[model samples]
Target: MRSLRKFLYWLNIVGMIAYLIVCGYFQMTGKPLYPGQVGLMFQVASGLVLVSIPLIIEKWAHVALPDILVVLYELFILMAILLGTGMQAYSIPNWDKFEHLFSAGMLAGSGFMIYAARTPADKQDQIDPFLIALFGAAFGVLLGVCWEFYEFTGDSLFGMNMQRYMAAGKPLIGHPVLYDTMGDLLSDFIGSAGMSLYAFFKIRRDHSWLNTFKLHRIK
Candidate 1:
């Protein structure tokens, strides 16, 4: 696990270095510093911050997030920045939607970790499966909404058009923005729902599932 963690750390470092080089080349060539250039920088910073989350939570809140989850989360963020948005993969049909789905699943997993971290092992059985699913899905949806809000803010603050809120210098106040935003939300919900349902059944069938998730049950 330590070796794998170190590998991921270095992988991110290399990816970030490559990203800066590419963006710098574009900037020097008089290309606009939008989309991939801006997004790559943001993703690199965000990935660094996310890499510290597990350790920070462990120290401050006494929470131990699963190592698998930490790796998965970092990989997804890197993928989005490095391949999806950073590579202009939105030109491919439904690629953005796939990313939204993936992100929501990651959020659902985080929710499961949080719930597991807070619940006592002995009392875990008393919690309903439906409640587990509901909590995880709800948490994922909340995060999805918050992400949309961030996109919205980005659109307002900069002309990045992160939310598909404009075309040809005119704001899209109608079906375009509505369709794009709602579609993302729906994808997020569906992805999260699937993860929550699986977690619910796993816990229902055996308490041993907790061991697989790598969270320490609170006393």
Candidate 2:
């Protein structure tokens, strides 16, 4: 875990620097960066937050997550840059759908881990795996809804049109808006549901699926 965290630490540093440089270049050249590109700046800020996750957990939550999950999240941070801001997933056909699906799964998994972390060691034997899994799945869906809200806010305030009200380079008319929103929500549901069910069944057999993942520092 330490080794993976170290690697992610440096990787984030380099990626953020390179990303900011590119954004700066676009600004200096007076090239109009897409709203997604403009959003890359915020992604860079978030990368810093991801890099700090370990420290935050160690200090506040005192939860030591598995190296694998830590690594997965670091990769997600990288994904936020490359696939999201750099590759511009929102602009590409079908990429947005894939992003929502993948993100929902990851979020569900993380939410399960967090639920486990909050469990006290003495009471862990009494913990309900099924309930936690359900909560995690619901948490993932909640995040998906919040994300749509974010897109709506962006569209309302800055004309980002992230909600696809202005889709395909033009204002969406008729059922198009409903179609786009529903599609994204559907993708979110598929991903979260799969992860939650897996966790639910797995935990029924192996309680350690959540309890003993080389995490649980507070114990």
Candidate 3:
């Protein structure tokens, strides 16, 4: 598992670097880059920084994140930046919605880990499992809203149309304008609820399972 995790981590980095070079070439050659392509370039660049955050925290704070969580994080970046954006997979119907759902589920799991890590070790098992599940679901939904906010801001400032507020160079109106954002939120909620339900049952069955997902402090 450790070897698999390392392999995936490096693979994502290489993918991001390759995308960056391609984007740079287009820019240098005065070629027109579509909005999605530009967004992909920016996201891939940002991913390099985002992926390093866990290692930085582990090194400086002595809080070691679980290897599975790290692997999932890297995989999410790969899917979103490389496959979804770089490969134009978003052009597929419902692909964006699928990404939102996947992201929410992953975030929900991270929420569970966060709740467990913040609790006192002695009291962890004593805490209500339902509360942990609720926290996970709520955290996922909260972040989903934040993501929508990001898209809205990007569209408002840069005309990125990230929220699908525009079509064919014309601004959408009424229900159509809200469709993409609402669908994304609904998908996110469903994903969060599904993960929370699973967590609740799993925690009730074996409290020790949560330990595998929690961050550990280095001695």
Candidate 4:
């Protein structure tokens, strides 16, 4: 089991590296960064990093990280190709409802990971799992906001060029910096908050049920 886990861990590392290399190639070649997509290689790389953390910290043996990477990759690629030439809305072939769904899932996963990190395994009373999860989700969302800010900066003041590429089919170059970024941030907050409340309430209810169902024999 140890050997297999080690192998899988290394495999994930290699796969993430390879993914970055491909993205770098795309950047260097000046090919449409996803031709019909919004984010660049960096967005995918960020998600890969999130998936990698649990594997490295917990030594997880499962294929979760790689699987997630694959899913995100395929989704982004498909979104890019079928949607349009850039992050613009008109280019999308459909309503793109999946985009919001995927974002929520990402936030939820991030929240769960955070809770895992904060909660202790040895004792049930060590910390409130719900609180941990909530904070984790918040942190994850904050990180996302920071990333979006970085993108904004790259496209605005700097010559990142990625912004233009990312905005491919959009009618305009610059978006309302504060408005759009805040709106996205709000969405992330909602996702995290919802997951936190759900987890907290669920844990409380389960504990109540378990306590009520405990068996006691009088001798």
Candidate 5:
């Protein structure tokens, strides 16, 4: 599992580097680039940094994130930034919504990890399952909102249509403009809620389930 995790990390690094090189080559050759290609280049570069964060935290903070979580995080970056943006997979119907749903669920799992890390192992079973579910759901929703804020900022500052507010160089109007954002939020909520319920039930049945997902402090 550790080897697989390391492979994914390197795969993202190499993939992003290759993408940047290709983009740079196209620009230097004066080749026509696709619309939003420039924005995707920025995303690819940012993804490189994003995928490296786990190692940075582990090395510098003396903390150890679970291998499964790290693998999931790296895979999300690979699919979302490397393939979704680079290959224009967002053009596929419903792909963006799927990504949002998956991301929220993963983030909810992260919330559980955070909660488990803070609670003493002996007292974990004593905590209310309702609180656990609420915390995970809230945390996932909060991060989902933060991501929307990021998309809005990117659209405003970079002229990117990340929020889907514009089409064909024209701004959308009425309910259509609200559709994408609202849909994304709804998907996020559903995904998080589902994961929270899973956590609530699993923890109630077996507190040992968290042991598989818990983070560790390095000595």
Candidate 6:
């Protein structure tokens, strides 16, 4: 078991490094970065976190819940950048649906992470799972806000407008709002909240009534 866990841990690290290489190559070649780029890095960080799982198994892990929260915040920021860039790239082809799906995944992943992190060492039910879910939803909205700001910056810098046909032409203002940046933001929240609720029910199903009560009623 130990060897297998260690192998999985290192394998995750190698996968992350490989992803970084691909992303760097794309950036160097002036390829437009996509929605999953930052997510790939986020997975790398998550993998690095997993590398400590062996220590965590031995109860020598140094990371605290707040530290984990900070990392989660960073993950959300990177995901927002990725999602916004994808939106910018595909805003012309009416392919914002893919962008929405990406945003949804970001929100959902954050929600699951929050709940998983809160699970106690001994219990199947996570501590304050609802609160963790709330945290995830709030961060989703926070990421959405930052994404909108990024979109505005892109508009200002690259002269890319979402309103009208904005790409590959002489950059101009008064684009016809081809995409709903705000709508994407709301969709992010929806996805996050939905996943959180799903996890909540899953916990309720997998554990005993006594354990559930312990999570809710214990000190």
Q: What is the TM-score of each candidate against the true structure?
A: 0.74, 0.70, 0.81, 0.46, 0.82, 0.42
Candidate 6: which stretches are off by over 4 Å? 1-94, 118-128, 162-179, 207-219
| Number of the candidate with higher TM-score, 3 or 5 | 5
lDDT by residue (1-219, candidate 6, tens digit) is 334434544554564566567776786677835655565555555555654543463354433322222333333333333322322334455355345544554555454454454656465444555664566567666776676787778777887664333546654345334346656666666756764565556554564322321212112
For candidate 2, lDDT tens digit of each residue in 23-119? 7688768784666566667777667776667668867987666654566566666666555666465457766677677678877877876776777
User: Candidates' lDDT values, in order?
Assistant: 0.75, 0.73, 0.82, 0.48, 0.86, 0.50
lDDT leaderboard ranking: 5, 3, 1, 2, 6, 4
Error of 2 at 81 (Å): 1.8
Q: How many residue pairs clash in each candidate?
A: 0, 0, 0, 3, 0, 6
Q: TM-score winner among the candidates?
A: 5
Rank the candidate models, highest TM-score first: 5, 3, 1, 2, 4, 6
Candidate 6 residue pairs in clash (backbone atoms < 3 Å):
162-178, 163-175, 163-176, 163-177, 164-175, 164-176
Estimate the lDDT of model 2: 0.73
Error of 5 at 179 (Å): 1.0
Cα RMSD (Å) between model 6 and the true structure?
9.4
The model with the greater lDDT, 1 or 4, is 1
TM-score of 6: 0.42
lDDT of 3 by residue, 60-143 (tens): 999878776677677766777777777677888888887777788888888988887788778878978898889999999999
Ranking 2 against 5 by TM-score, winner: 5
Tens digits of lDDT, candidate 4, 1-219? 345444554554565566557656776767745552225445545545654464453354432332332344334333432232232443443323344334544555555544444444444345565655566467657766775778778877865643234444453444543444555566667755665566567656553321211222223
Stretches of candidate 4 off by over 4 Å are: 1-101, 157-177, 207-219
Best by lDDT: 5
